[model samples]
Target: MEASGYLLSGVLTGLFLLGTVLVLARNRNWQHYSPAGDASGVGETVERLAGSPGTWIGGFVLLTLGLGLGTLVVVGGLPVPEGVQGAATVAMAVVVLAVLAGYVFLGVYHSVRYRGLYRSQAAAAGIWIVATLAVAGIAVMLLTAG
Candidate 1:
């Protein structure tokens, strides 16, 4: 049941992130953009940011860190040791911070063309981060207390 709770929370978090990305893409007019064509200045900026290698790298890092930590908690059999809940809480806070940083990066990276999208992304990212933290908090509480 605990594992299920964690998995469910993670899935929900991912879905929210995906939705935010989709909305950002749409708002930025990047839904079907082609960087190889007649792109205006704004389009060029969009292409540069959206097609940036750094975005992909950041995404990869997020994927790796999230999976790595989750795997450690599950496979390493590191049950919430007594008094260690603080550590788990801190770690979740860090994850939330990372998510916020990523959103900021996305916004700044594309600010040249997608200012509106950046704002939307920031709002959506905040929502997702809060939701994830809430779920993770619940999971940790259950794991530690139960």
Candidate 2:
């Protein structure tokens, strides 16, 4: 279990880092493509970002990371320091919550900003919500299991 947890953590971390880099690269490409000015509004920005393959892949990576981390915690495989396990767990929970909040904010902002162009916002938000909830549920189980 411990070995599996460590492996999962490493894999998840790599995926998350890769996703982050790809997203940044996509943003840079966007800037180069649109040298004139910034995106018009939240809607346009979200649309552009969401339309990219990188963004979609990155979203999946993040979701996987959250789910994997939660599973690790619940399985009692996370190699957190014995003395700081509670603090570590709380910190991880906070990070997962923040990611969820970011997704919701993006979806709501885009929907509100571009009522007409709110095409994929719902889908994105739904995935985020589901993933976040799954992670939260697992984390809760982990906390209570002890």
Per-residue lDDT over 51-104 for candidate 1, one digit per residue giving the tens place of the 0 to 100 score: 999987997798778757755664444776645555655676677676666675
RMSD of 2: 17.4
Error of 1 at 86 (Å): 1.8
Superposed model 1: Cα runs more than 4 Å off: 1-78, 113-146
Candidate 1 whole-model C-alpha lDDT, 0 to 1: 0.66
Q: Give me the candidate number with maximum lDDT.
A: 2
Winning model by TM-score: 2
Q: What is the TM-score of each predicted model, taking all chains together?
A: 0.28, 0.36
Candidate 2, run of 10 with poorest lDDT:
28-37
Instruction: Return the clash pairs for model 1, or none.
Output: none
lDDT of each: 0.66, 0.67
* Residue 64 accuracy (lDDT) in model 1: 76
Q: Write the per-residue lDDT of candidate 2 for residues 1-146, one digit (tens) a residue.
A: 87568558857986896798678757743322225655568878888998999998998898778767765765579776655556556767777777777767666656654765344545555565566567667766765664
Q: How many residue pairs clash in each candidate?
A: 0, 0
